[model samples]
Target: MATVCISGALVDKLRACAEAGFDGVEVFEPDLVSAPESPEEIRALAARLGLTLDLYQPMRDVEGVDDAEFARVLRRAEAKFRLMRRLGVDVVLCCSNVATATIDDDEVSARQLRALGDLAAEHGIRIAFEALAWGRYIDDYRRAWRVVELAAHPAVGVCLDSFHILSRGHDPAGIREIPGERIFFVQLADAPRMELDVLSWSRHHRLFPGEGSFDLVGFVGHVLHAGYAGPLSLEVFNDTFRQTDPARTAAQARRSLRHLEDAVARADPSLTGLEMLPDSAAPSGFDFVEIIAEDTSTIEHLLARAGFTSRGRHRTKPVTLWSAGRARVVLNEQHARGRTPYLAAIGFEVDDASAMSRRVAALRTPRAYRRTYDAEEELEAAVAPGGTEVFWAQAADEGEPAWVSEFEHGGPRIASPVTGIDHVSLTEPWQVIDESALFYTATFGLRTVSATDVPGPQGLVQSRVLAGPDEVVRLPLNVAPPILAERGGPAALSAHVAFSCADVRALARAAHLRGLDILPIPANYYEDLAARVDLDDDVLAELRELNLVYDRTDAGEYLHVYTATIGNVFFEFVERRGDYAGFGAGNAPVRLNAQSASSAARESGGFGRVRA
Candidate 1:
């Protein structure tokens, strides 16, 4: 772990790393300088805590400068080297000159590095030269390696940072050209591809491995193939991590490395020595989704209107299970006396629950607290970064699920068109959107889809989707715009579970007849839909009457309906014709506007103030 990646005092950061199972940490220079403890005291504390002071960083702008500037660089280098000795760290990161480089020649930079290396050699310190992505020159790892080669100093070797190399679109395959022994240290960070200056991006948006768009497995493969056998240290500089809990962030960092290691091993079986975690496989489908609320009557009524029948109530807890065909919803009132109804847990049907649970443990995800009676099913669950509990249920070969027996039958089952969960849209706390994506990706092997930004009534909401293999399961994770999040977050807007059916029009009509309090679609929406797509006049009229939203593509067509918000949760019913795999994103703006309007109407005694 890198000290800069975690937020807290230096001592607290060290403790967090140790608690999170990191073998060592890269000490950022500012963190060290701001510490009240002497360097020797910090070293002693690290020893007591079982953490290696792996690398002291970073000596910057030390190369590509004039002789007078080089002399000052060497002088500064000697002082940091002495500090490293006192810190009990051998390797010091020397970043390529980004600001003070008056000379662009590699040989001049090499000569200066060699001189700095000579000064470091006296203090028994190694110089790990790294390229800053925005360096004035020597901005590429390949160029940094060339300079290291030219330096030809025993104490000098190149440092490879994933961000510096990958962010510039430099091919990592070139790493194999540099001998592994010359690669003194390795710093790993992943980042979403963004159009911004590399310096600002590096300082603000870097993520842990598996959390971003980079192909880190291939990147690390090239490094290991070159025989680099150093600690795979994390070096992220994310704005979120800098303010979040250090212990939690450190745990997340360690899990990211573990996940990356597992991915690399799986990608290349020939790397026999690399450790692997329990393999994560895509879940078959959603088993059930649990909602906790103080007033279960409102949710129960909504479910009934949507064609769901009460399957049973838990024998040992205040929980009820409702079903419509294969779709199941759990309502729990226990420990939720005063809270608004919200999604609490999701159960997935998997081929092997035990193996999935093991993978969750291996990934270091915190287990959710479940209060179970002695004879009830042992439903193992992991808490997501967004605080949703994820439970895995093994598919039974024949007969009902074993856990279903815990709920006594309430009445005869009711037949309905809703087949199963189509998808669940989660509103994430702004800070943990990236973390939530990584958690799902690493835990269930879900792959990320292209993210979309939907304009909401409050602002533009960023939506990222993750899907199971073959799209058997889909999760649309959304982050509210900053203004709305500042007010209360996307949770204040709503999270919803979407149900799939053969015909959404029929379902919506049925729901309306049953008085489901369907969300009202403005007549303007139908007019706009008519302009966007060629639909039969009668069908368009039906959609407007039933408050149904429609979206179409060359491949297929989609229709879906929504229920008015019940507390913080809502329900959506959808139908897919042909291969329409989208979530009706084109219709989201209308839906958001209607929801906002409906919320305003409810708060203002049904006479909502008009929105322009």
Candidate 2:
């Protein structure tokens, strides 16, 4: 890991890295300078923590200069080399001259690098020459390698960085051309594709390996194929990561590397030095969704009005089961005394529960603890980055989960139109939204479909959706606008589980008759919809009367309705027609506005409880 990837006192960051199971760390120069400990003391701390001080970086603007400037660069290089000796590090990162290069000739740069390498050799240090993506002249790795070859010094080599190479769209297949010994160090970082200058993007937006859009597995494969055996260190400069807890961030960093290594090993069996993890396949479908609340009456009433029947209580726990068609909800009150109602956990039906459990354990994901009786099935679960528990289960011979037997059926089933879980939407904390995206993708093999901005009352909410194979499991993870998040309270949190059905119009009419507390949509919204959507007069009137939202695409149409927010959780019913795959994102703004208005009215005590 890179020192700049986390925030804390330099010593504390080192401890975090060690605790996260990193064997070594790249000591970014600024962190070392700002640290209070002497270089020798820091070295002692790393020794005690079982951490190797891998590389002391970065000796910047060291090449591509005149003789006089070259002499000055050598003096600075000698100083850092002395510091590295005290820090017990042997490799120094020398970035291509960005600000002080007066000449563009590689020969001059090569000569200067050889001179620097001579100085480094005296101090028993190796100079790892790297190309800066925005360097003045030697900005590409291939050009930097040419210079390293021209230098012809035993102490000088090329350092390959994923961001510098991949961000510039350079083909990594060229990596195999460089001999293994000439490649001294490898620094890896992934980044979201953004429209920005290279310098600003590198400094602010770099994400972990699986969190971004880079083809890191292929990149690492090329490096490994070249026989480069070294620590795969991280060098991220993300704004959010720099402010979070160092320990948590370090653990997250370690997980990313493991995930990437697993990917590389799986993609090509020939790759060495990669640990192969247990195989993970997409979940078959959602088994059940669990909600926890201190006062369950509100949700109980709402679910009843929406046509959910009380299946039964848990045989030996403070939990109850409710179902409508294929949709099942586990209402947990075991640990809900001080908590508001919230979407707590989701259970997925998988082909192999044991393999999935082992895979997650290998990834170092935090386990979610649950108590089960000796006679009950022991379901394995992990906590998501957004604090949602994820459980995996297999179906019994009767085509229902074995755990269903724990809940006794108290009454005859009431047939309802709700089919199954369409999708589950969770509002993530701003810092962990990207982390959550990575977790779902890497841990469960979910594919990110789209990322969009839905305008809310305060600002735009960033929404990214991840879907399983055949689109069976869809998750819309949302990050609220900064202003709304800053106003931290239960009112700011929003999450919902959407159920699918064949006929939303009929369900909405039946729900209205059953006295569902539907969110009120503005009449103007329907009027505007009429101007755009090709809805007939009767359909449009029905939508307006039932407080439903609609969206259309070239292939199909979507109809959905939302229940009023009960604490931080709510319910949504959706109907998809003719292969529609979206979550009706176009109607998010209307829903946000109506929900905000409802929340405000209730806070002022002007809105009575809209209940059956």
Candidate 3:
């Protein structure tokens, strides 16, 4: 568990780790030193919390020194070993000396470590020697292991840290070569790919597993394959996590461990014998999207223009279900807030909702509950990292779903080409972008497809997509950088829903005839498109006439159209042909430019009238 060395008061960290379901903890020496409690008191607290004191960590700068300094370091090691005896910890993590280590001889280092190991053995404690990435004499795990081998002490063993090894670009496969009994401890951390120095990068930019770019599954698999049967602990030093709420950070950290374990178990069949979480449920498609607004008339009008008809009205609340083919939109006016027409909830169709809920519960995420009416369906729900509500429900077993009985459906039908949800786009703050990505990936078993930078009116928007294996449920997360308040608020680069259709041109024509406020496209876009793709003149003319944008990749072609902003939300219509897999991201700059112009025109009272 991360409680061993993470930030926060020692007691709070232990309580949080216990509550997060960690069986053991590594105790950082500083946390112990700064605590008001004595070693005996800390040990009792760990006992009460039902946590084992696995290891006391990070006795730094201990080896590769001269005779006099070595003598002094042994005295310090003796004191720590006595403390560990009282603390009920069996092992201490000795980091390679980064300072005051003049001797570069492995035999000298080994001789010094042997003496320390002798002292630890007397105190009934062990030493797990680790290599610091910035160590003066030894910075590689393999080099540290060689020194440990030379020491040949029963009380001394090598500690392998993923960050120290991977951050230095060292191959972890060599870990399999070491004898399993010699590998005493293991520490895990993931970091983004950066060009900065290792010290600063490890301290400030470390992220939880699946949140960073590191390939930790392979790293852990190698360690397990070597028959290392110890607690897989976390030793992250992230600046942001240290400053955030400790309880929330602990919960996220625990979830990351489960995610990593599941990945490793999948990669190595031999390791599947170990206890692991259930496999992620496969998502079929989106069930419905819900929006919350103060007033529903504007959203209703927009839905009408897009050829969606009111299928049912909630029996007990001011909510309505709008549908077109397999696409469903629930306009919920029960709760209103600062942003009008904000996306409130998303529902997914999974193979088994109950199994998915069980897996999510084991990760320590909170479950969401709501008041249910007499005939309403009670689907399992959970709160996501960004406070968005996620509902899981399986397809109906027979007839209509149980939830539909709560709504009354009797209205004139509107027919159009829109079929189902193509994708749902969500906006996240810069700080929580990575957290949100990890949440969806871990919860729904989604894979991040690609990330791109989009030029917005305010600044560059970082966009990434999380999609299922079959491309059924796609969520595009957009993060807008902080902009000065004077820049007319950050651009609305997110908060839009796209609907799939058989033919985008036909849907655009239908929406235009229904008086939808279509976003105007510049004629230059068509001219550029003509130069880019080889298409018939008639097709190009039709695209320009309906204000549609076109893009084609080596795999396939895409066509899409956008609607003017309605309150804080907008809509999109898309068509894919020949296995087109992207969101037509190449057309984002033009769309953003046009939307900015439209907003400016609206502010000046010069834009065309929008029907309400």
Q: Quote each prediction's TM-score.
A: 0.97, 0.97, 0.92
* C-alpha lDDT score of every prediction, in listed order: 0.88, 0.89, 0.85
For model 2 the local lDDT of residue 88 reads 93
Q: What is model 1's C-alpha RMSD?
A: 2.1
What TM-score quantifies how close candidate 1 is to the native fold? 0.97
All models, RMSD in angstroms: 2.1, 1.7, 2.8
Q: Rank candidates by lDDT, best first.
A: 2, 1, 3
Per-residue lDDT of candidate 2, residues 89-114 (tens digit): 99999999899999999999999999
As for candidate 2, its clashing pairs are: none
* Residue 371, candidate 2: C-alpha displacement in angstroms: 2.0
Q: Residue-wise lDDT of candidate 3 within 1-612, one digit each (tens)?
A: 656435589998998888777888998877888899998999999999999999898898888999999989988888888888999999999999998999999999999999999999999988999999999989999999999999999999999999999999999999999888889999998887899999999878888889888889999988988989888899888876777667777888888888888788877878855556665576788888888898877889988988998877998988899888778889988857455777778888887877898888877777888888656788888888777898988877654456766778747877779989999998876666777888899888898888999987777878999999988999999876577223434235348889999988888887888898888888899999999889999999998888899999998999999888876578899999998999999899899888888888888997773322
C-alpha-based local distance difference test score of model 3: 0.85
In model 1, the worst 10-residue window by lDDT is 603-612
**What is the RMSD, in Å, between candidate 3 and the native fold over all Cα?**
2.8
